[model samples]
Target: MQKQTGFASILLILLIGLALTTLVIGMVTSVRSLQDSSLTTHAQTQAQIKSAIGYQALTGLLKPLTATQIAQINNGVIKDNGSPAATIATYKVVTTTEGCPASTGGKNYFCYDITAKSGGASSVVRAIYTDITTGGGSFNGSIFAGGLQIGHTRNLQGDQTIQVGAAPGGENGVVKGNGSSTFYDDQAQFTLATGITVQEYTPTKFMTAEELRASANYIFYANGKCAKNNLYGASIYNTETEPVTCSSISGITVSGSGASKKWTIDAASSAIPVGVLWFEGEVDINLNSSRDLVNTIIATGDMKVITTNQSGAGKAYAPYHYYLEASTNAATKKTRICGSSSTGIPTQYCDTAGTLKALDTELAKIANILFLSNKNITFDVKSNSPMSLYGNIIGSGGAGGTGASSGKFTGNGTIDIKGNLSFTGEGLTVTNGTVNVKLNRGDSSGNVTPSKKVMTLSGLRYM
Candidate 1:
């Protein structure tokens, strides 16, 4: 009996020892599992932080440290606490030039590779660029480029192919290669042109007056008619407030049909020419004649002239003509003509009461009407020397009394008057130098009185 009790006691002791050993083993396993989990968490946190830094650099939201900005980013990112399992990383930026000049000159490109180093591993951010003209002429991208692993052997070497922007025929998502792709996740954070630069242009505001006055003899046209009339219709005005230098004219031609008159310029001889002409309502005819004669046409028009006391010297006047003194001229000075015949003023202002102009105002009105009427009237005149014509001449084969004072004329002919001539009209013109009888105004007075010459035309000689 005593031996049996002893065996049971020994077995109970062995069982207790076994149980304690098992418990100890389980606790050791639990502790090891917890340690492994903690290590994994720390590694993951480090990876996430590193990746976040890289992403921020790539997107440009966080600008690349301008030596100054970098210091700030680093100070904010890396804490001074001694809780890190690994040492803080250092960074270096590297640049590469492939098909570009060493220094960015015309069309030079660059790639920037930024690597952040640590004890165990390293992280890098890259960017490839084409815009070198923005930042002091150099490649200014992220830290990594060329898909090269940071602190790894798998990084690419040599010229890493880059892309510019979207090409014509490329994939929808991302095109690859230099011909297709515009964006690269490897060589650069962005694509780059083969070689390119940028520049800025600005204009200055300091010019001399002489530079502005370089242009002369400018012609300006306004409204429906011109301010001056040459042979062709009327000429534009030169309102430069100064004299305009122009070439000389020798002669001109005039011809046309209908109520319009055409005047053409002629360059046959050498002669001093008039500067400009003013046509109110007549068609101007420019003729290609050998002499300075421009042909014109006349229509049935009326003449109204008012005379002011033209001169102080006494002068004799006939029914239609006026005899001036040899020296005291009566027709070569200022004279005013009105529309009323019963006003008792001579057609030539023959009374020596004031100064009389050789050119008659009524005649000037008639000429302007014919030139601007744009009608047809055939007449020709030319001059090699300076001359003037006064009074009025009626055409159109109709008794002259009523005439249009304003109209347009068109043609290519000649009517040369070197000296000043007075022409007036409200609606009458010679068109293209064509003789048209429709423009004639018959005896408007309605009186069957005998025809009386109202005025005489002087300084008018035809060839």
Candidate 2:
């Protein structure tokens, strides 16, 4: 009986020991699982922190740089903090000469690949920027102006684009005057081209007067002479204060034809070393012959162009007859003021080899013909005669009035332009005539191009 009792006690003791061992093993497993979860959470938090740091570094690095400076940057790595940090994220910059996928053909742009890396993970960012002033010396559009107004029976036609507003904060528009005037694109009356965009009333500033003068090829006084003095006063035509007559000026040689003549300022002629010409007083360009201008003309005061004879009989004369002749070579080096009375000037007239060559050479060096005036741009037109002009026109004091006292771009006859126009002070008004424009892409091929020295941020991408 004693032996049986001993065996039962032994079995009970063994069972208790086994149960305690199982409980200890379960506790160990639970602790192990908890430790693993905690470690994973800590690692994830570190990674997130590192990523944030890397992004911050990239943003700070790119903020203040100009487009040129950004393009010049070399491939390299930058740390989040100073060199000897305990933990550091990194940003890598890589530049490519080619454009991004969405960039236009022939655009001057640079693409940057930026990679941010930390804690075994990375993010890639891309940016594309354009050179705004790439074609600084040239203009591709037909007409650019500050304020524009057209009257009844008038047509503003062209195959090129038209731009308005030389700089920000200036007034600009294509006035809705009874909706009688018409605009034509690419010889199709009342039509616009596929890719042609009219930037009407955009608030963007262009080059300043001082900036343009600094880029001048030649400086002259009134009456085609060199500048020799310095003076300043309120304009007789406007309220704006400007340099007095002949105080600061550029030079040009005026010759060829009747009272209406050609103004020449060839840099190769040794008289003017540069093709840009600046005049301190009024600039009077009389369109008398088929001539070529290879220089930009800037005037401080008013700029005026008028036909020598106002009577209908003058249209039958030599230069005036050629001016009205449909057969006259529009492509040659000539000043075509107005379209032919019978048929409007064909687009082919302005596409001559000689005219292109002369204009191209000038544009390659200085870009476009920049005609700047402090007061107004006056066009005196006769009845039944059309006036045509080629170049960029800027009136700083707005449009002069029809009266002898008002400073405005006022006219009583039809008008045409193959360039850009801008007015700072007032607006442009054309009464009883049409204003036509045939945009010029300031390049050797006469293709539409962008301005030089202007830059804008195009797009950003992330990978």
Q: Whose lDDT is greatest here?
A: 2
TM-score of each: 0.20, 0.42
Q: Candidate 1 lDDT (Cα, whole model)?
A: 0.26
CA error at residue 273 for candidate 2, angstroms = 9.0
C-alpha local distance difference test of each model: 0.26, 0.43
Each prediction's Cα RMSD? 36.7, 15.2
lDDT of 2: 0.43
Cα misplacement distance, residue 363 of candidate 1 (Å): 66
Task: State the TM-score for model 1.
Answer: 0.20
Residue 316, model 2: lDDT of 13
Residues 251-356, candidate 2, lDDT per residue (tens digit)?
3455533334335332222222223456565566544333323334666666775544443311111122223233556643143322222222211112221122
Q: What are the per-residue Cα lDDT tens digits for candidate 1 across 1-463? A: 7658689789999999999999999999999999887776666556445644544443352332132332243212322247564333323332343222243443232333334433344454443333221111111111101111111111112222221222123223222332223433332332232111111111111111122121111111122222222111133222433232222223423344333433333323333122222222233233222322211222122111111121221111111112121232443322212112222222222222332223332221122111111222334322221111111222221111234222222222212211111112112222223211111111111101111111111111110
